[model samples]
Target: MEKAKEMVVGIKELSSLPAVYHQVRGVLDNADSSIIDLANVVSVDAAITARLLHVVNSVYFGLMSRVDTVSRAVSILGMQQVHDIVLATSVSAMFKGMSPANMNMTRFWSNSVMRALIARTGAEMVRAGELERFFVAGLLSDLGHLVMYEVEPKLAEQAQMLSVQSGRPLHELERELLGCDYAEVGAALVDKWHLPPRLGAAIAGQIEPALADELYRRDAAMLNLARIMTDAMEQKMESEAIAELFDESIWTLSGLKPANVATIRLIAEMNHGEVVTLFFPQLRPAG
Candidate 1:
């Protein structure tokens, strides 16, 4: 784990979050932080501000009135919600212009968006109120693989191939091949970013919620279920095999019913394309 963290640090491309992201975070760290403080820092990035308002006004939120300004968006969503939006937006932007030749960036983002939506549905099924956190956690859960493919493409490729060849989970193969899996790498990177600790924790525990502290277990469980459902949705696993991949403990721990599986997948797939376009329009080629 220590070596994996060090490897992530050595990668220059993902060294830091955007400046505005850090600035907003610094204000968020201050208890006296207000909507104005968030608006001040976020407005500097016109693109983020625009997306923030768009999402605030989108069918996703279903707001009754127009939200034309970052301040109005912040007031409507509250500081914490706005910060999560900023975190999601800035994190998405950080990966822009990174056209890694080997990685299918579009497919990667599609899977992420799908996972995020599925996670949100699962959160709702389980009655977890922190839906945005669940969405962000699922959206970024696979990011560690990006770091691995960036810094050690050959080894990462080997691990991916082995998973397909051996019929074992990728995380298991990653441990054997790289000494750490995407969950650990993603968690370490999230921790380094200084976002919410539980976000990092939930991602870190995607493979096993018990790996996270008690406070974050519910979110972690939600993330784990979402990943499994994404695999099932993408046909990465067979219908019969899908049930096997589910962590039964998540059902017990999260109160999310298996009966909700079809409904969750439907909702995730329904909005996935739109959500992908909203968050990563770069993935779409020239129209």
Candidate 2:
């Protein structure tokens, strides 16, 4: 439709996935793919491989081995963990030079990395399987909001203003005022990019917790809790609507506890200062 066209045309900041990254995605989607397949794909892209290695050895993974090769890194972190890192590193690169109006891409990506890390930690703590994909889903959950900023700055700004003034979630206000929310637009991007189905579903269903498919319901909850953790850590107001939207049983099923919420929030806040290195190696702190 017209909206789709506008989105495609206006998203000049969005970059196409590199060939190696595309191959990595393919291998990730296939059940029979192995670490050697990922290592082969990663080896072809020296820049990505370097960045991937840098990220893996960084404080994020806490690897004591000082990994220097893709194969060894894969052995240490597993194929899926590398996939999540590639996806995050790739997307982060695309947004480096992109300065959205009324929004800072650096800060935006910082917030995203924080959400992803928290989601992964929360998933592991709560026994959610495939923690890495949940991390990627958490990272991309807000992608629609980015698209809105690119495609319709005026409307995006207005929606943000309204959300702030009315204390309503931005996605809800965006749907009311603009006929669509970022979650849907983000889902469209995921489809366009041909990412894993779980990622698309997770982004699309983030705002509307009830609409997520059974397979991605856990992803939705992970993203939901990740967002809350992010906001609570930043001392921003928590999304009461989102908190109430997902049932307590989901959290219990995931093995999360109310008592640990404060601990996670504090750790996430402390980790925020290190987030820049999740992408920019040159910005990494000195030992």
Off by over 4 Å in 2: 1-9, 29-33, 236-254, 280-287
| Residue-wise C-alpha lDDT for candidate 1, range 1-287, written one tens digit per residue | 89579768977778788888888888889999888988988999988888888778877777999989888888888877787777788878889877555788888888888889988888887678867878889889989988888877888899999888989889998888889999999988988877788888889888898667988888888888888878776775544556566667888766776677777877887887777877887887322
- CA-lDDT, candidates in order: 0.82, 0.74
What does the lDDT come to for candidate 1?
Answer: 0.82
TM-score for each of the candidates = 0.93, 0.87
The candidate maximizing lDDT is 1
Q: For each candidate in turn, give its C-alpha RMSD to the true structure in angstroms.
A: 2.2, 3.6
Q: Over the stretch 176-253, how does candidate 2's per-residue lDDT look in tens digits?
A: 777888778888788777788879888777754556787777677677778766765455545443344346755753
Mark the 10 consecutive residues where model 2 has the least summed lDDT.
Answer: 278-287
Residue 213 error, candidate 2, Å: 0.8
Q: How many backbone collisions does model 1 have? A: 0
